[model samples]
Target: MRTLAATAAALTALLTVLAGTTGTAAAAGPTPLAPADLTGSVAVTGISLSWRQPAGGPAVASFRVYEGGAVVRRTATTSAPMQYLGVNTTHTYTVTAVSSNGVESPPSAPFTGTTWTLGMAPQCDEPAPLTVFDVTSSALSVRWSVGRASPQLALTVNGRDYGIVPGTSLRVGGLTPDTAYTIALRRANCDPRTAPVGYATTRTLPGATNATAAPRNLATTARTDRSVGLTWPAPSDGSYVHQYAVYDGAYRVATTWTPSATVTGLFHGTVHRFTVAALDVAGNESEHSPVLSLSTAACPVLPPSPSRVTATAVTASTLRLDWTLESTAGSYTVLDGDSAVATVTDPGAVLTGLAPASPHSLRVVGSLPGCPDTPASAPLTVTTLPGPTDRPVAPLGFRVAQPTVVNTYDADVPLSWTPLPGLAYRLYDGATVVGTYPGNAVTLRTRGAERHQYRLTAVNANGDESPPTAPVDVITPFLVAP
Candidate 1:
């Protein structure tokens, strides 16, 4: 007998060939059957039911299958030698035959089939052909050529399998938005699962905080009414950064690979400060750099206040004064006895045209271009014509270390000076002698009206007092020993 192969569909084509009637060729009448001559029982997945049967002939039209007290049908022919006695509703199943003349035969025997049992779980197996095909920012699709192997094969995830659903593809949702997740696949088909076979890991999408390396060298330049052009190195500096964030203080200005950013809607003729930060793939942001400052072209703003104004008695007609220079100081003025004696555009203030041996009161004032003038320094009494004789000679080999932070005038600040074999040395607080050290270093308590002044003078064997030297403001007392 010839068996015809069917179409491309697996189950449809397979069943089409097996669904034919018995004795299509030259077989004779139906043969006699006995339970003792029956073949062994067979089982298959997805089949509603299965059975064993004895051989017979073409005269038999079908078989009567029995379960519990009711009757079910298979092929409806005794000679077909094949029947699908599906055990859908009953506990035990048995099969008998029916002839073309409608004669019913005795029940064949009963056997127990597969069903759900309490505490009886399916066998667990590794996923077959579990392969990842496509990966995206938030998901990865994997294909596994895995199916049920037993009467009831369950699909397992992580460790346990969920039974019933017969679909192949399953979506792994609720995964981390932008992180790696370890997935372990499992298939349960036994009473007790041994272990899951398939294991895989994949990364997910990323948010803004999940940056690795941030931007670098973010600076602003070129100005219009309200627009400013900002230039940066790159988003991913040599691939160190996964992305970048351009921020205007607290808010993000832009996010992308664009190296240059144009910021508008700024106040005209006003200067603004901006900053840039970088991020890497691991979500680590680098430290922020120094603030880059830029401004629009406007009239010069008021200058900052001046500090630490020092006056040196130059002469009666001329007094030279120095001050710590800052960009904000527009001009310096020398006031004598509440009157502006000299006003100079230069940072230093010089006062001239004064009477000799006169007790003149002087004050230094700092003023900006448009801002109000501020008088900070107190009235200083500067006398003139103490003459070139007051000039002092510095002791030989003078070296001292001043404290930048903790300065105590009484503290012993170490000093190294050239050894003067015969000349006696004296330390002066301005014109007055403050101390005399037998050696190069001497401990002197800095004392004065405004600040401590220090100078060194040497005496020859003739007992002549050398002129006084320039003094320094010892704000920190830690430098007292000299």
Candidate 2:
């Protein structure tokens, strides 16, 4: 009985200890569930893996992806993309869920995937068989071929990448003149370990020189007061010439890429000496061509004043004037008093439309192209005869326009009036008739510094006169007639 009691007590104590151990585990927290539905998608050199979250367990904070029993990625999302793997290879992966308290659950089932084969993956073939041609002082052309059809190749000039080239041939410019350069072509978008497929070395042609590339037949084509045109034959080595420089005596006046050029802004009636030289792409100048002489057109001069002016009455309303000049005159104008009457090309001009039986004062002036009219000749006086008996009505609206300047030696007062047909107008200076004119407007030449009262009247061919206009006062500038 004593041994049985001791055994019962020991069994009870063992049961209590077991119950306490179970309660402690329940208080700690729930265990995280492992990820489920693990799967993978394959690519050329990579695998993308994904899994579902546990449906019944403590919330997961993160997921860990395992590859070949090693943790390759730890992510909070359900998917992960793996890269940089060997082509035509296989990979296996697994995933586990992590609790908020940093506890890890059991891993999900392993998944296997295979990358694309070497033939199935994208490929870049290297360019081969390089050829160089048409090399010049500042540029060169290159071409190449490939054993198989492929994407365009990238070009390397002097170890610098120039991006992908679209065609098999390329012409490169903006290079140093007369220089050697290294060129290479390689497959584009390929592994960095791949080597270039084609390489070539070429040197540009030598630069041109004045002694070797001087232009021939440098001749002047045209000349003007402000400009000159010149043209020349291309040099023997024309392929090397890039431009031409024109020099005025010793100064460089112009530069052109063609064989001809124009020099501008020259002085009128002046002689000029010009020369031209050839320049290469390297800015090397050749010896200048033979000097060419040219002369611009002469500057214009004012026409000389007329001399020996004479007037003669031809009819009651017509007169003839003649004059001579030293230089060639383009035309001559006859002036009655200070008003221009008519213009003629020859030395003599017929002055028509004159008042009958009226005294007149006339002079001649010459004009030339591109010059001002010459000064008037000394005045000549003449009188016309009377006509049939007929009287004209009185003129109206007579007035004067101020500020009239005739010439350095004379003062002209401009006057106007309403005109009548078949009649002539006459101006009076204080009852003394100054001059008679055919038109309603007249310019009266006055002398001496004095205010004069003037009146106007209309006269017929019969020497008859109408009532005079109200007198107008005119203050003349002090001048002496010559």
Candidate 3:
């Protein structure tokens, strides 16, 4: 049934384009109104135009025959009951329904078509448009071209109306899985105002075919605060997947086939979700599988919090003190051993109202109800870390970012800092000098390591160091962008 309809559609088209040129006498308007009903049979093949009984029109000066939209020949009054069309080929033709007044009705509709021999040029209307990429899943993305000259071409896939774009791509997404599609193209010429002639067809890409590879089951396991483990069904199928995409919910997390993927620095007791997608040689990704979610145990208990954080001296009306909190106790609680202080939720506490050179003391402690309480923080007794005497100009231009940490993939790192000449950088690994370099900039490259402790100190060539700057905590994941 589909083939029959296609034949009719093709015939109606070829005939319309060729017939308007019939009879040498141009019609004043659109198609000749009477030709449509003329009784006759026409067949098209690349080589010949065959017709049965061409003698019924008025006065018949001649019978004009068309093949594939081109005039093939004109036969005089006496050619027999039927004319013999040339060799095997796909062509469509129509005959003129003429009037005795040397006028011809519009040519008859086109007929069944056949293909021509190899030596003959193709009757295709335009240069074959290139078909670009093809991707299949529920969504298919493909690009192709129709003639650049025609603005009215419409493309149909499996007889379904696909919206057209001047450029070649059709992102046919949200389609059924494992289905085949046929594409067709059509265009019309307006000067003559005719139906389209160009047509073509191609099928959707194959998915999970007997010749294609299938997914192998994968296994995942939790590792230390650093990584996770990944395993997969060996390539028993004899085909290798280029890479695997790990998923956490709808977002993809990683691409690898490694039996063990050590995921690092995840929040304690928090569950992480994961799944795997495979990449084929064609760069097509496989559908994600069932999810793999796991929660990590909390990091090893942290050392007990440091004792008493306090504001020792009130110099320049500024109070200062120091203390500690248990690192691993979910959180911390502190008391301002300095003032008639109440216990504070945060680790640091400050006090006011003091005379210059006067002294004061503070008491502090760290506690986690569920865990062991640390020894009471010792009394914090000391003068304030000196206040600035004058406006000490910054020797080098520097930037202090708010919460200065940048997130990369799964990690956070400190903002980069640059120094001016005559200025030296002192990078610390906890009060210990890791670097003392003379330069305007320091670029740190920490490959995939998610969490780290870092701090920097700027010193002038005079050897006087600036007050200790706030420490920066960086957390990040492996894998830099390409």
Per residue, candidate 1 scores C-alpha lDDT tens digits across 253-355 of: 4554556777653433444445555545643344333345676543223323343455554442334554532323445676778786655544454443344
Would you list the C-alpha lDDT of every candidate in the order shown?
Answer: 0.44, 0.63, 0.42
lDDT of 3 by residue, 426-482 (tens): 665332355766765455544233233455556554333444444555443333323
Candidate 3 wrongly placed segments (more than 4 Å): 1-218, 235-239, 258-260, 265-267, 300-343, 347-380, 383-482
Residue 126, candidate 2: C-alpha displacement in angstroms: 78
Model 3 CA lDDT for position 191: 30
| Candidates in descending lDDT order | 2, 1, 3
lDDT of 2 by residue, 205-304 (tens): 7764233455668898887655789999876654567788776543467899888998864434445566677776665566556567676654323233
Q: After superposition, how far is residue 464 of candidate 2 from its true place, in Å?
A: 35
* Candidate achieving higher lDDT, 1 or 2: 2
Better of 1 and 3 by TM-score: 3
Worst 10 residues of 1 by lDDT: 13-22
- Note each model's CA RMSD in angstroms: 46.4, 50.0, 38.3
Model 3 residue 169 distance off true place after TM-score fit, in angstroms:
28
TM-score to true structure, per model: 0.23, 0.23, 0.28
